[model samples]
Target: MKKITSALVALGLGVALSASVQATSNDEAVAERIKAVGSVCIEGDDTCGGAAAAPAAASGPRSGADVYTAKCASCHAVGVAGAPKFGTSEWTDRAGKGMETLLANAINGINAMPPKGLCADCSDEELQASIQHMIDSAQ
Candidate 1:
């Protein structure tokens, strides 16, 4: 009877320890799930949630000519999807509409043009410069 009692007590202690470990592991998993999964960082805005540190800046803003050739030329060079061809009547009308309108359209996208002309990495200033470059070349 004494031996049996000792064995039962040892088994109960082992079970309690196992259960405590499992509960701790479960709590850690729940904490991980409740943590933020991602974050957003907008240019010129300092209100991004503190999910991550800011990325290092690139060398610098790419030149307008380089940006146009690399990004805008695909559509604008040949007037794909109604994109104004550089140095033509189409761009003349667009240029007459004013730079602000053009910049806004380029940044936000207009008609079939994707936002930022699908130049996901280009900044607003770079896009504006590219637009100006196209307008200058077309004239």
Candidate 2:
């Protein structure tokens, strides 16, 4: 009877130890699975990676029609939110406000239009060009 009891006690200890080892392995596997796959380094953070590369040189300022089509057409094409409709009298009337005022509105933003009209990278000359393109489209 004592021998049987000792055997059962040893079996229980073996099972418990095996279960503990299995649980530890499972935890390690879960951690491996959940670890971040990649990391991000902000543009100037040397500690994260290395010195940020300089921005590529631009070919030059894009043409007025190209800038207008890419950036301005979304709203101006149909006069969304009161933007002057392209190729319509609305642009003509806004043109009467003069280029100075128009450029101000474009750069500084007006009403529903955000500054630079969603073209954050566009230079002042580019913005002026786009404005002129729209003005020229006036019918």
Best-matching candidate per TM-score: 2
List TM-scores for all candidates, in order.
0.57, 0.58
- Where model 1 places Cα greater than 4 Å from the true spot, the runs are 1-58
- TM for candidate 2 is 0.58
Q: Write the per-residue lDDT of candidate 1 for residues 9-121, one digit (tens) a residue.
A: 99999999999999999999999999887766676566764435566666888999999999999998998988899878787788898999999999998889999999999
Candidate 2 runs further than 4 Å off: 1-58
TM-score for candidate 1, please give it.
0.57
Q: What is the lDDT of candidate 2?
A: 0.91
Candidate 2 residue-wise lDDT, 1-139, digit = tens: 9999999999999999999999999999999999999788778766775434456667899998999999999999998998889999888899999999999989999999899999999999999999999888888
lDDT of 1 at 57: 60
lDDT of 1 at 97: 85
In the predicted model 2, the residue pairs found to clash are none
Clash count, one per candidate = 1, 0
| lDDT of model 1 at position 42 | 72
